[model samples]
Target: MKVAVIGCGLIGKRRSQTAMEHPLSELAIVVDINPAAAEAVAAQYGCESATDWKAAIAHPDIDIVAVATHNGLLAEIAIAALQAGKHVLIEKPMGRNLAEALKMAEAAKAANRILKIGFNHRYHPALAKAYDLFQAGAIGEIINIRARYGHGGRPGYENEWRGNPELAGGGELTDQGVHIADLIHWFAGLPTEAFAYLQTAIWPIQPLEDNGFGLFRFGDGAIASFHTSWTQWKNLFSFEIYGQKGSLTIEGLGKSYGIERLTIAYRKPEGGVPDLEDLVFDLPDTSWELEWQDFIEAIAAKTPYWGAPEEGVSAMRMLDALYRSAKAGAPIHV
Candidate 1:
């Protein structure tokens, strides 16, 4: 497989590295608005660089395109790539809004190509293990989930492209919130309703929230509460799920977030103290590579991709509903 990675940013660099490392794939091209950035990444992988994404998309040699650009450009690039008969791995939040996401999905379907969203959280070692346990009934039927993910912005973060609504659509909610929402959907299925509160307490980015709090109620009576913040003084990632038989909690995300760990506890029949087990992972993050492998496998098997376009649409629908609910100051049906 020949891969072309657009954007050449942090995430794009990771995607390029993963493609280069994959035995079945080669990093064919790298594209970025800034020629220097694109050249740097391409030079690192001994690949070609281009300033125009359109040219990269039209390149006949490229088989897979990794759209790692901002939220607003994801749909446009992905749709074009799919139309060109190239599979796409787009970064999350798949698009600026649901409409754009749907259009991308339609394009993927029309072109009969694979489109996978970059919900790399699902591939995290700790979270992956927790998901396995949940599926094996180790946690039994899920009842509720609580997740919080946040990071303190660097100096002058307000001036970054993410602070601009035109480029980013929303703020932290559309940013980190989508990851938690996708995870919730992965573990508990889709929600039936959503309520949200958005605020710009710290950063001066008006019309864009710096913190987002949301509550989602699922059809199966499972509820999920999540908060995505840019005001967190310390970087953090924590997700806990409660089930009829026990509970599973995943904390940290390595590096600044601390050592990744998963804790499982089961209730005692007599109702005293519960039995607990703690598993820690101190290895480097391989989520990007693993997710890439999954995408490749889905294409090779001609099967539905794990984080397919439909999954992106579902997560975006939840985000859209939550944003509407926040605007109306009431719960919105999903």
Candidate 2:
């Protein structure tokens, strides 16, 4: 498939790396408002570059679009590509809020195109193992989950657009909590009620929360809780699931999610009590190669899709619910 990437930012460069190295794919075009960054990445990847994304979206040969731009623009680009009959892999948060996300999903549905959100953590071997164990009944019925993602607020944060709500969408909650919300939906399924507490603390964020705490009410009477911040000294993204017979913990960043060991404490259902198992894994295949390959295969097969646009919309709903609850100091129904 001929792939085009929009935005040559940090993640855009990383996402382009996979396409550059993939034998089955061609990096045909790259776009960014900053022509220099776009041109540099395009040259390094042996592709053409453009500052005019609208023109590139209309390119006749482009089969896939990777919307790796800022959160606000991803939905717009994806909608445009779907209208062009191109499949898209959009970055998370789907949109700044639910309304735009719903619009993007509607566009994908209308166009009959594959729309997958880039929640690559699903490919993490730690999470894969957890799913396997859960399916095998090793964990029994899952009862609770606790997760947190933290980092020293991005450099230049005080003066950066990331701290600006209009551009960055939100503070740590929207910036990073979207990942947690995606995980909650991915692992625990949708929830019923969600309440959150968000505060800026010392961060220079304006009209956005730098620190957040949330509680999710699952359908089965189980509850999940999460806390996250960008004010920490180091980056930390990790979660643990509590089940009747065992608990599982997965931790790390992009591509590193599966590199760490999967720690499990579970009872074997025999006479003995639960024990701990540490399973080390190689790094995750998060280079967009696996995701790209999968999307291409799915498009070719013309079968029922995976990670459809609706899933992205559902995730956005949860995020909006959490933020609204944070603002109201009460639980909000999904």
Best by lDDT: 1
Model 1: lDDT of residue 163: 89
Relative to the true structure, candidate 2 has a C-alpha RMSD (angstroms) of 2.2
> All candidates' TM-scores?
0.98, 0.93
Q: Clash totals for all models, in order?
A: 0, 0
Question: lDDT (CA) for every model shown?
Answer: 0.93, 0.81
List runs of model 1 lying over 4 Å from the truth: none
Q: Lowest-scoring 10 consecutive residues by lDDT in candidate 2?
A: 252-261
- What lDDT is obtained when candidate 1 is compared to the true structure? 0.93
Model 1 C-alpha lDDT per residue in residues 1-334, reported as the tens digit of each score: 9999999999999999999999989999999999999999988889999999999999998999999987779989999999999999999997999999899999999998999999999999999999999999998899999999999866675688898888898899999999998999899988999999999988888899999999999888889999999988899999999999999999999999999999999988889889999999999998988898999998888865578888889999999999999999999999
Candidate 1 lowest-lDDT run of ten: 152-161
For candidate 2, the per-residue lDDT at 294 reads 68
- Could you tell me the lDDT of residue 309 within candidate 2? 76
